[model samples]
Target: MSIQNFLSNLDPRLQRMVLKNEQLEEEGLHTEAQKENLIPVIAKVTNIGKFQKITGVQKVTEITTAPDRSGQIVTAHIAANALPTVNKSPVVIQLQGAQPVKPLLKDTAREINLPSPQESSGNGGEGVIVGIVDHGCDFTYSSFRNTDGSTRLLALGIQEMMNDRTTSFQVYNSQQINKALGKPDPYKELQYPVDKYTHGTHVTDIAAGNGRNNKASGVATKADIIFVEPAYWDIPRGNLGNFGDSINFIEAVKFIFDQAGNRPCVVNISLGTNGGPHDGTTLVEQAFDGFVTDKPGRAIVIAASNSYADNIHTSGVVAQNGHIDLHWSIPTNDFTLNEVEIWYEGSDTFQIEVIDPQETTVCRVGLGELYHDGQIFASQEKSALNGDNVAMILCDVDREDMSTGKWTIRIHGSNVNNGKFHAWIERDNHTIGIQSIFAASRDNNYTIGSVSCGHKSIVVGSYDAKNLNTPISYFSSAGPTRDGRHKPEISAPGHGVLAAASLTGNGVTGMSGTSMAAPTVAGVVALILSEAKALGVNLDIDQIRTILERTARHNPPSQQGWDSRYGHGRVDAHAAVAAVRAMAEGRQPLPSAVTQEEKEALVRR
Candidate 1:
């Protein structure tokens, strides 16, 4: 009998809710008996109310055929009232298994309409090392090499050395090092050699592999990928409760950071600890935050863990009893705020770092005075063109302010011959204290400073492509550090992306996640660093974050600005390149200290 008949037989009240139409045909109903017997049978026998209770579905709307012709299918458009009140309802239906789709590769790869990379005319990110901490990488894969004797992908086997009893580096045979060196295969015992599962390889390819031989490309096509294997073969017995120890992870990080390589490099950590970092129990923080540092051109880019599962920090923060919390607050008891004092010891005399904010850590250095209205003002002391420190002030721009005037931040360059001022912070002044107010406004980027909490690291989040349809990957992590600061200093593409993978010979694999997202960013960073070096612009990680955040593409304000989900909306590679060019030509202005509003506004755009 049809599902409807079954449901009607089970409960007559369900008859009106279940209907038959093209949906059944779409489900591939090949025979009349199957069609006639399924829906009514399902409706008659199925407990609609019980099904709704279990699935958070309102009244059953329709009983359709399965996408595949295997069986009858049912779908429901849930009601607002049917949302899970106590806990999230797990999806009960098992989806049909699908084969991986091979990504299409263009004959000539093109970057999304962002301006061509500044240093991309020649090799960019060449020789820079990026670390991928995941399952494993297949060094023997062919896509890792190029035809002209240049290595497109170089694999540093981290898993092979996992269980070696020797503390000495020589434990790895000469062959393994040869593989790392891109030399002919010389190794004997190759356990966990090439990444058997495709996750790590796909991620590595996006960061480094050259788009040669009809392969999908990566953003940093010239970088070297160092794979840090976290576990042995998937312990089929692995369970959520038994998260594995990541000693190899820590060791891999230490090895990369300690490498005395020549090229200025950046490390990308796409994986995130499942629990919230603020819970104070995740070993990830102990390994990452305790070690990653900001020293000149070297840095690390970490993806905020995606909020797929319920989070006490986010979900719990929602106000109950009609007390909706539109904002987060800093605890008054925290001494980090009251102890704020400007300490300057760096050689750069033109800029001072804003170290503390109402106990929240939103650290960034700008050329200006700490002003009221929670902003940093550029110094008008010198009538320096564009670089003058007066354009960084942020205001809680109400409708009146928008109607009356628009605010702007300035950038200054050393090449300006005339003493013209470029102010980046100039808005009406308000109360000046070391605290941030949790208000919903376009200029509230500074209010949630989680991503920037670890001011010393390069924190990134993800956004949809220009086409913007599709759930933001549930795997991409969000930010607003436990301390109430904006995090993921910026956002990038983390979705159903196509990139090169380690298949046997010049092969490719397809996958998606921030794991792919972060390497694309690291490559961009490498390009920026190259431009800065060429242009003689001495920049720091904070400067890069502020520049990227300020110049990124802006989405509508209906979506919160600098929210944990998408910090600084989507990255505008073109805008970033333009900013770099303008800075190099002395056409751009230097930014003043940023106010909460100004910073938020920059990030929102």
Candidate 2:
């Protein structure tokens, strides 16, 4: 897999844990099925998604069989012998020969032929599809419009209201988007409340905005667009709602890729969670790896989360025949749930207990047991990676006088050998600001969040786009995953990236985060896809990763190749695209013969 080739090569991403909370009925979370299950579960799916830690594979049923232009995608469900199998895939990529050159990409208008496809005359991501899976997808923005005032969006998928949770995919094709653009209130016509979410619009614009608003255009201006708005994405832990799972994120990516058809597609994910075994084997991460490996001409880019300084991670070891207590601080004002996952070598059997801030043992679970009350839930399960075990505790208060501040989790080593463990507090996505944290033993390292840590994801870190003095954004997470795999393949301008304000006609705003950087890479990858399509070449995940890493520019100049912060260095779109053209032409893909002026020119852009 190309992920192994990433930063001395190794892999990592998480399953969306369904917490029994009322907010599950919102935008990306509802499915009706989840609404009724009122308890936080690491749910197992019998079909149609990815699964992890299934001890045996009793059955393998191919859900859908079709030959993708790149390769065929065979999604299957694997569950433990007693439990219904999870919809996970042991992804098999049977690479086919070069696909015949397809037509010019949708709405591209013209075909380009240049010796160096990255030249200004080369198409700006034409002949490629850019998929965006995030919230607040506003297709009405001018940046998404063609020169003729028509939409450049290929399609948009929304997880509709709760009643419609069981309904089929609610899709808006290009015609529907165009119709919405003509109405008095485009959102009313489209049924997407874009005003609530500007994140998607900003990310999409950065990846493929056409620059119609006199603002800076995105990297792949002419690339076609596909978007999916997961229901639970917009509001994070609002109304004392339960914590939402990222399974919707996986579904969102699947929908985008499904909608993309055979076209070369690059999807951007500016969303992630701070919890998961950093070893890249969580069910959802498995899904990500499966999807990316399903075929060539497919790739996913994720923001390498901003939890670097959040104190969301901690690590320690329990002495054999001894015990340890982990302190987790629940903020005084936070009304949402707090979840912490402790991962350790499975060879050691540990009994766990969760104590509230009042110093009372609220719930206890021994080896192979799961304890759940409305307020506290604890469990110990076989880990999906490295034959390890995961101890998880989640708190959902029941009374008005809820416990606040440091909660202690006690881990007693019953059978000890390899008693070391790692833990992470869940991420906060909304603006309420308050979040739980580890009170002690916090480690900023290994902070790249799940899905971004997936083996197939092109994880991106943030550079201070607006502050050259700081180069890297303070919040951009540092990594070499828990398993010691280099992460954050590259860095890009994220801070202060200005783009269209959600649902505001002609309005723009500036936002900062690693979320802003990932889309930048997605757009650049689109250019690479476009070039590959033009040259009639087939590119798998590994090949694309190689090109990007090979062409990255050294950030600090003296820093040697491949560090945890920036896998290669900062991404160079022009160099990446040029390398693609060079590969197709059988020349030096990343030629080192460029003149001083050309290097400066690339730097200037």
TM-score of 2: 0.79
lDDT of every model, 2 decimals: 0.40, 0.65
| lDDT of candidate 2 over 153-193, digit per residue (tens) | 88988864333122135989999889988899888887776
Best by TM-score: 2
Error of 1 at 310 (Å): 5.3
C-alpha RMSD in Å of predicted model 2 compared with the true structure: 9.5
Question: How well is each residue in 1-605 modelled by candidate 1, as lDDT tens digits?
Answer: 11111211111111111222223345664354323221111111133345556533433433322222222223332321222220123332221100010110221123333334442332455555666665546555554555554444344544332111111122233345445446444223443345344776666666666666465656556566565664423211101111112333444555565552544566776654321123221222323443433245566676654443222122211111221211322333221211111111122223322222333323333432233221221111111111122212222222331212212121223232322221111111122322323222222222121222344556665544524442345545555554356666666666656665554556654455556667667666766665566666656666666666665544521253565666665565545555665677776443533233543443233
For each candidate, how many residue pairs have backbone atoms clashing (under 3 Å)? Answer: 86, 13
Model 1 residue runs over 4 Å out of place are 1-122, 149-155, 159-192, 195-197, 231-244, 260-262, 276-294, 309-453, 466-471, 536-538, 556-561, 586-605
